[model samples]
Target: MMSVCGYRWYPEYTVEEQYRDFNQRQYICTVRVFPDYPGAEKPIHWSYGLGVTVDMAVQDAAYSMLTIMRARHALLQNSELCYVPASQSGEEGYISGVYFDSSMEDPLLQSTVEMLENRDRDARALRMELYATRARLWTALTQLAPVVQTGYGEMEMLNPVRTHLPAHVDWPAIGGVTPLRGPLLPPVRGPRPHPCPYGSQGS
Candidate 1:
């Protein structure tokens, strides 16, 4: 039996808007040729794009994508020859994709993979580490004690408390602090004017 797969493929795309480390792009310039395999093959057509920032690479999420593409290859090849749109835009973490077929042989496919890899590397590098993440986790488990739980329970290191309120008040965790009162300004005195009602001329 012929199997089918639906995935987003970005053919020719342009960046309509861009922001820090991300770009919102649009692409719809390819026509898919689905002459054969229409009836026997379950024709499914859909596309999606993804972005993964560098620091968020916990549990080797990067590998998951490679695996997905690798798996989707067979299904992609069986579908009608089609063009899909794929795009990615976001701060720091961003991944983009284009409509693609089942093989990694396409030049565009190779380039797209390279681009994704580069973005991943940039993100990983910007955050400055892989092991540092592990180390941080290690520290959380082995070192710091929770401020609240003085008992022997495990703890994680947390950032110091930040305050925007008056220094005189106690800063408790989670609860909001009362804002300090400021001096009120006196109301401006304006001249009182007599209003002429009804007639324009005063008799």
Candidate 2:
């Protein structure tokens, strides 16, 4: 394919091995083609394949890449054909000197883009609803503040127990004693007189 396309560079291959057990192993091969010519502006074309041996994996990967290139008309049998740059083609699917069918209108890419758009729309809607809800709550609180204050004032004026209560109470000084700070307890009445020593006459 490179020779027909007037490319002098060779395709690079990388292999990796996955050992499932002592007797079971899987090999994966990746083939990448880089632009070697000076005036050729092309992105790297790559493909992957899996097999039981390194040679088999490499062959599989190479075959898959060639198949893709053939489908895209990237490989030309006649060297006399003029090459077209991807930029001049005005199509995103065009790479190197050929148009790739998969690059344009791919179902996976379309679906992914649609999914992201929907997610973004939902997020924007949620944020708008949150802002509106917050604004309504703030308005309700602002409108209710004066009514609440007036009701509290009326209750304070009508309650006689509250009116007679002292604003503050001073704790009596006790030697080496500290006064506890909390809700005040009612003052205790004077201690009751001791009972008579003798029992009641009726008893």
Candidate 3:
């Protein structure tokens, strides 16, 4: 059986210039759970972030996760978010671990911490929290362990705050390197050429 959830985060996606035409969009990214016969609506969608302040991005991330609950994990509706959003530059990160062992009385439990420290598939950081077990949430949260893919990266247990990005020695046009205002409409491709502002053809 497969399960999935939707999450969102405003990564510190730096730009050479924060352009004038930069319009805020309502993002409705979708995800899926295999072996689950959910239709299109199964994926999450929300507009609360359209033109919303940066402060609301974390709430939007939670909403995105809830849209998944409305489809898959109905029990999580009562569960508070383990983490909220934090900001550094253009990157908005999530606040996890505060409630990590919140559900464990002997908070120093080894197995639980090991789970938190371990890496999920693709080596993405994993946010492990021992959510309080309830009749409603018992079966659900456990099953959710393997399936939740997070956009707000996990706290690296060793050095959680180490800042780095995709190692780029000299990759052209990487990490918002493009001139921000270059084009509003996407480029058209064909045998014939389109003219640029200098009266020269082709980009």
Candidate 4:
């Protein structure tokens, strides 16, 4: 089961955006394309290109999208046709050649499996804290102004506790010590469900 019987096919993409930080006139372009597989929860590959003109950016993006599509198609159909945007040399500006990578057990780009698991754990903790905070607010309001009418024939004004109040204060976890993950996806690429030649670690 550890050995791959055949190569799996998946789309690859890259997206990039470039702009001059000091220039207000520069435009930023984002291009995105994918296989559009139905019911796919994983992300699609993309590339970004920054250029002085809109045409330049669009041209690069289109070329990149085509390059990835052709590569995948060739691998899947076992065709002799192959697209190598640049030479194998890892030069600064040249396109790096594409090749098959079989180490699918590795972590996704910018993220690790362990980190993702920890995020889930942290999310559960934060949720519990949120519920605790809500409960405290309800209790405080009840005590301040119970089910009674004021002399003016209106509910008395209750100074509810501040929203910033801690649900379960843990000094050790305050500040940047234990930053909340919130709803952020890991800053890493996840393994493809089906292996692709671009650099799939597993099938």
Candidate 5:
């Protein structure tokens, strides 16, 4: 019922700094999803908006995360149903609606301008035509349901645009804010020191 989407900002390689597209500064935003969860079959990762500020990038990522959460919540609410991985499916299909209705003839019965001025036979005919048109439209909408799409189509709607990172990007060094040449790795964490039984190390 929760989304695993996480966000990060790279201000050094911003669109404004690299491309000089605009005067205002922007950020290179990245989102990583489904990496650590055991429930997920595979990870979904993507990024967006080199032109957007850091705050805006976070907002966009949050919106996508919420959408995933909603889908998960719906599945949890209905335990009888199972969720399909739209990205992994290969089927292509669409739904069709009803083709014919006698009500289509009503358009042929429209009244002329002369009938409107005279308040004559054509006026009564126009009223009948209008009524039939409304009825037909209502019937079609109420009777027909949208077709269920294939997994690919569902995946298209669900997933965000995939990220394509540029080559030869620089990364910041540990404890330093400045960018250095080459690809960056995740920060390494040192092991926690054992607590002393007596007191300070000096003692």
Candidate 6:
């Protein structure tokens, strides 16, 4: 099998005899597959089998290894090589004479799609929060405009008294004078401040 696949090296095997029940003995065979060159540093795959005879045990181990290679698309089937689609491979998805493990492709694609969806959701939430904050700030500023203008007018009206009164005088301690409180009064003149700049203008 290794020669057919263009590998110059062959599989290595180890066998051991084990005692079984009833004074019987069994053979245990282990096979290790290495890369094509001699003295390869590591074995690519390994399998073990047990049988009454050494030959049977070795054959069993070889069969197990072949099964694994077939599933990985490493072995030729019916004298024809299988091709994997590009979508499944996630890159060049299709190879004319090569096979790959198609099982892992779907999960990789699903994870990528899920990550994009999560990012989109987070961006939309941030935009909504920003819009809400701007709306609340505009509302507060608009509601406070009239009170600010009324206070400014009152200060202007009191300017004369402020200039004539002695510097030692404490207005809050004098008669018929009290601190401004309660609901704010309306502006004495002119139109109200304009609505929020972002809102539509209408007559």
Per-residue alpha-carbon lDDT of candidate 2 for residues 47-144, written as tens digits (9 for 90 to 100): 77665556556765665566455444534523332222121122433211233333344576655545544554454355346546645654664455
What does each candidate score in C-alpha RMSD? 22.1, 34.5, 20.0, 23.2, 27.0, 37.3
What is the C-alpha local distance difference test score of each model? 0.33, 0.47, 0.29, 0.38, 0.33, 0.48
Residue range 74-110, candidate 5, lDDT tens digits: 4443432112111111123111111123243245433
TM-score of 2: 0.34
Q: What tens digits encode model 3's per-residue C-alpha lDDT throughout 26-145?
A: 222222222324353333333222112222233333443333334344344344432221111122333222113325534564555445434221112221121122222434533443
lDDT of 2: 0.47
lDDT per residue as tens, model 4, 105-155: 344522443443355345435534654665575566555443333343234
Clash pairs detected, candidate 3 = 12-90, 12-91, 83-95
Clashes per candidate, residues 3 or more apart or on different chains:
12, 0, 3, 13, 0, 3
Candidate 3 lowest-lDDT run of ten: 14-23
Instruction: State the lDDT at 189 in candidate 3.
Output: 66
Q: Model 2 off-target regions past 4 Å?
A: 38-43, 74-203
What does the lDDT read for residue 198 in candidate 4? 28
TM-score of each: 0.24, 0.34, 0.22, 0.28, 0.25, 0.35
lDDT, candidate 4, residue 131? Answer: 44
Candidate no. 5 TM-score:
0.25
* Tens digit per residue, CA lDDT, model 6, 97-120: 223344454675655545544554
**Model 2 residue 105 distance off true place after TM-score fit, in angstroms:** 30
Q: Which candidate number would show the highest lDDT if scored against the true structure?
A: 6
The Cα error of candidate 6 at residue 157, in Å, is 99
